[model samples]
Target: MKRILTIVLLTISITVSAQTLRKYSNEFMNIGVDAAALGMANAVTAYSNDVNSGYWNPAGLVNLEDNQLALMHSSYFANIANYDYLAFAMPLDNRSAVGISLIRFAVDDILNTTQLIDAEGNINYDRISLFSTADYGVTFSYARKLPIPGFNYGINAKVIRRVIGKFASSWGFGLDAAIQFETRNEWKIGLMARDITTTFNAWAIDKDEFATVQNAVENQNQELPESTELTIPKLQFGVAKKFIYRHDFSILTELDLNIRFEQNNDIISTSIASINPAFGFEVGYIDMIYLRGGVGNFQNELQIDNSEKIGFQPSIGVGFKYSGIQVDYAFTDIGDQSVALYSNVFSLKLDFSIFR
Candidate 1:
């Protein structure tokens, strides 16, 4: 069963040429990192002020008060795939900060069935082998407070790596830019530009491995795939405000607009661009315990009757903080509103100052 599934996946991948520009290249990077953000349906652009900012909006890294480390893990597709993240951030003087983050998503133990049948037409289960497909991303971020008070800017340089067993691999690079501003009234605004320079991935396929599959299945995969994948720029704008009551209880509300250059099934779609809006809020008591909820991923879905229906994803989460250590958990979908099962995400953050 595993062998059959692997072959089907491989064949589908082989059908795409390298020259074609894919609309959803490097999609693994978009899965998000922190549980707090995921629980809020990824609406954290304006107030992500911690180690995870390296992946959200780097400009928020400037708000880090102490050296911090973060880790996260989540499973998807009924545990067939695993996603993990790690990050560290530190303040450089009082006005500048730097951070590094690493992310990985992988599916392991896929059976390679190209050699399941022997050359003499004999069935041989021993010839089957296992392999894995994985994607990795590493990002370095730097943020600084602008000369103007309450203003900050940041930049990120990212490297992307992907491998499908020993059959194919790719290396890609990209950049991100972001800015944040706070008003005297305590309203926060942020903008993030992903793939600001247009990321590119150069794929290299192992012809020998590919040939084995080609010989196994006739009239398919006859041509080698030589491809460079391109990812166009995307923008996210967000605004947030925090309301405090009784000096001990607070509520933070945030709204984000995710914009893509091409038209799609987003709520607001046009020839020039598409916009998907997300809204989230967090209720906190004494800054130690919190509850969060959000709605996002708005799309127009075609029902069985060929009628368009608006669909959205809703998520909820909880968080706890004590002595500079924070733990968060979220129950949410993996950005696909069609998926019936939601994923459980957990993350931990530690501030170095706790030891001091």
Candidate 2:
């Protein structure tokens, strides 16, 4: 039964194998924060007051009344775990703010494989090794209230790095800019641009650094291409609508779209067309309690479960307030698995605000 389970898992994995590398690749950096993840990509225009705002919509920082620091960590289902984001925003005398943040994502223990032959004239499993995928990026942002009031704009500078299994690494930079407009009617609108630099390039592999006595791996001994960086195109946008029935009740819904121009079969970039849509909503009473859910679907190209044949990317989350600190959690189901292959997601977030 265990063997069968493994087989079933492998089969399903193989089918989705194409997305392994780019599946978790995201434009929204604060993936672990439940409220954001549960609503697909709606957090882009959604108001974020946590330290994670550095990754979601830095423009939201303009609303801070005090300087605050934050940290967040997450463990993805499937033995994949990552640490991300630490930031502090300082509110100025006016409705302007400045903040700095750092985020990192890492995958551990990947088995390296090679097709090889042995002296016995038969196939043999030559070796297995562990490799890691990790990336770290630093961000700096500034937001200010418009002289006309009730309007704001912000921009961020990001320095990022992508490393692959010690064989290579790529480092570059990009920018994120945003605009926020608010009305007396309690309506808000926002827009953001990501990776304006169009970052690209991968590290050059050092063939000369190959481990000793191994002919099984490809290009055991061959001159390599000049070190080069892989190109990745980027452009993502998000919109949001908020409804406030009273001081203690509200409903928030948002939609996001991103487009990927280059086509590749790797795990480094997002699997979608760089042009995918994610929608989600949150309903709450008095800002004291909340409920949230959303979907991130890509039709036939990416389904949560092959059995259902529908890309049912559904998510749910909740939030609570205690004094001035708030806590949140989210659960998600990535549609595309058999009963045994569960892709459920859960995460927690904490927020501290000075305003009563």
Candidate 3:
């Protein structure tokens, strides 16, 4: 046991000393778009049962029995930014399903102060402009339950686009795959591979489009023309269980771990880290009303320094389901000591079985 503990400690130390967070393009892809999932700190990979599952775990789309549509919107940091998502799913048969989804994250109407002055150093407030930065994605998802009663597989093909104030833009593509298993006794397991083919973004900047403004503003940095960025593949595993105490009362609990492989400058060789572990629970009453809570990013010991707390986000939410409609609301704190940040998310879902 002592030897094992020593090895474990050494691995963690090596990991911490070797890796630094690398910047990636289209970071909005990492944001959780589903209110229910985010409310549970994204531990729903194994408990996916709704249309939003198209984004969380495509295999979960097999759980849908009706044509479903879901919409969600979130306001972050007191309305500093907005994130929205929409998804629709339909069952093609008893064992197959397909889904389509869209994501938009944006910060609009920001003042462009870089060109506020003329070349002769005269104040030109009229030269100031307003612009928006936005990221978008369209996803096509397909899921199927194998001949085996409890096994399912799914895939997602996604197209990504990002615009930065009309000065720069990017286009990218990626794929994700997932598998899930369930038993008669309410135990579930899931695995997901995100960006399985290595999502790549090819950026094209029209620097000449801003040439007039650049000439008007002195000492402004020149924009680059083209570049490419690759998003490394990520793997996640989850397990969940449901406990039923009464016909109408039950609780669901889940745990998830995320792993990412990236270039590590601090260590001689590439290091592996199971960095983000999340825990969540849901209490349901009659399947009509629900309460949810979760905590994530508690990687205190995994950090290289005392001041850098990589994890520590907590969230809570509530939901109501009646007839064929479901409504949910969630609150999450994503703050640090210097910046107090919080987000509120709301979602609505409708299910209708026209073919049934």
Cα lDDT tens digits for candidate 3, 186-222: 6999998999998887777666745544443344345
Residue 209, candidate 3: how far off, in angstroms?
3.1
**Model 1 over residues 1-356: C-alpha lDDT tens digits?**
66666676776665452445665788889889888898898999998899999998999999988999999999998899999999999999899999999999999898789999878988898998999889999999999999999999999999999888888888999999999999999999999999999999888888898888787776765676667888899999999999999999999999999999999999999999999999999999999999999999899888999999999998899999999999999999645675546899999999998999
Which model scores highest in TM-score? 1
Candidate closer to the true structure by TM-score (higher is better), 2 or 3: 3
Report the C-alpha lDDT of model 2 over 9-121, residue by residue, as the tens digit: 32232222223233233333534343444444344554554455566667788888667766555555464756555677777767788988877777777554432234464
Error at 27, model 3, angstroms: 2.0
Report lDDT (CA) for all predictions: 0.90, 0.57, 0.77
* Model 1 misplaced regions, further than 4 Å: 14-19, 334-337
Point out where model 3 deviates above 4 Å.
1-23, 210-223, 263-270, 301-311, 334-340, 353-356
RMSD of every prediction: 1.7, 7.1, 10.1
Please give each candidate's TM-score: 0.96, 0.71, 0.85
Poorest stretch of ten by lDDT in candidate 2? 11-20
Candidate closest to the true structure, highest lDDT: 1
What clash count goes with each model? 1, 19, 1
lDDT of 3 at 153: 94
**Which residue runs of candidate 2 sit more than 4 Å off their true CA positions?**
1-43, 81-83, 109-131, 211-223, 230-233, 259-275, 302-312, 334-356
